[model samples]
Target: MLSVYGVAPSEQLFKGTSEAEFPAFHGRPVGGPVLVDCKVSIVKLGSHALGDQQSWVWKPVTQGYAVALENQPLSSLKNHLRGLRTLKDESGQNRLWPWFDPRYLKLVLRGLDGDDLVRLFGPVTLFAFALENGVELFSQQDGSLQVKVVSKC
Candidate 1:
């Protein structure tokens, strides 16, 4: 199965290297307490068999942006989270595999605002997105997070 590795960006190892040199990787070590070390299957991103299971629907908001809405107002994501559990032994960690429905995962992720997206898909996946958008995260004076797009990647 294709996997998503969350490789950390090491300053000591890649300080002067270009973005192209950052390894294209996925997944993380298994059986760890922290979720940043667990691998998630890319196959989970495949379309679902139950077409209506989608919790979010997107509509174009602008030329390059779209907004997602919950398919049902009463059926919030918190209810569906009960079905999203990690392996029997992998409790206390955030990695959910073998049981997670990618569709629902997408919905939950879509529901999260900018500040909540810091750990979305772990560092490597976020790094890939930052690289694509030429953006990086920074802390504000008030302790809030912000996205800063760099002139050069």
Candidate 2:
């Protein structure tokens, strides 16, 4: 389950749900009071680990700038990550590291393409499924995670 949380450019993108809220991690680097009144887009990369919240943390950027990520199968995401990693920067060095390092993944994610952004994170696992797009997941104040439909206009 790859969960991408962001303030959608417009509220009209979502259907079935009229609004969604992004809990403000104020004082945090990715802090936000993100409130989507109309709708927000949610993309499902694939099935992932059921527990462990740390594995789901990706970049700490705000909506339209970054994505909240969850893990997927390495076999499905490796090629995309490798391709992004091989890209050269202004200094002519590999833009990303060849190895998987959680500490550095956030920085690397900032440089990924939108299409590739779907699965820019996750634990190095083999049991996950292939990537797909559809339902969005969110946690309620009661500590339960729920799913909603997301679409782009």
Candidate 3:
């Protein structure tokens, strides 16, 4: 399974590196110029270099600066996430949905059901993130959201 992380710019996970080292792309569409500082980035994970830097990265990820997804090609997963960036509001206006942020993800998950929930999961078979005391894992099973919480030992 391929593991990918959607990292928010505030985390600065790639501050001192060249794009070739981490190979990240913004979540926004490809046709226009956008502010890189304000966009969410999609990056592949599990490299030896990343493992070495885990100490610094882990805390930001746990604090909602990133989200993990598994079992999808990088390009496909990026497209899926980009599509979810904006949502129609109650008044029919498009609003930014910061669903990748775990704090917002918890709230977004609560209000999604049936197709809405399934749509969110899309091609990603598993979603995982860390909370203050545990890691939350989300998977779609039998048309519903199934969550597993692994507490810190």
Best by TM-score: 3
Model 1: ten consecutive residues of lowest lDDT = 58-67
**Which stretches of candidate 3 lie above 4 Å from their native place?**
14-37, 47-59, 63-71
Q: Give the alpha-carbon lDDT of every model.
A: 0.26, 0.30, 0.54
On the 0 to 100 scale, the lDDT of residue 44 in model 1 is 14
Q: lDDT for model 1, please.
A: 0.26
lDDT value, residue 84 of candidate 1: 39
For residue 78, what is the lDDT in candidate 3? 66
lDDT of 1 at 21: 21
**Residue-wise C-alpha lDDT for candidate 3, range 1-153, written one tens digit per residue:** 555454444444544321112223345532234232253555445532222224324346544333345555666666776776667778998665554556566667667889888888777766666656655667777568887775655
Lowest lDDT 10-residue stretch of candidate 3: 16-25
lDDT of 1 at 10: 27
| TM-score ranking of the models | 3, 2, 1
Better model by lDDT: candidate 2 vs candidate 3: 3
- Can you tell me which runs of candidate 1 are displaced by over 4 Å? 1-99, 124-153
Per-candidate TM equals 0.22, 0.26, 0.67
Alpha-carbon lDDT of model 2: 0.30
* Residues 1-153 of candidate 1: C-alpha lDDT, one tens digit per residue: 211111122221212222112222235533333232222221111122111112112111010111111232212222332333443233555554422322333334544455444333222121111223232222222223333444332
Over 4 Å off, model 2 = 1-75, 95-99, 111-153
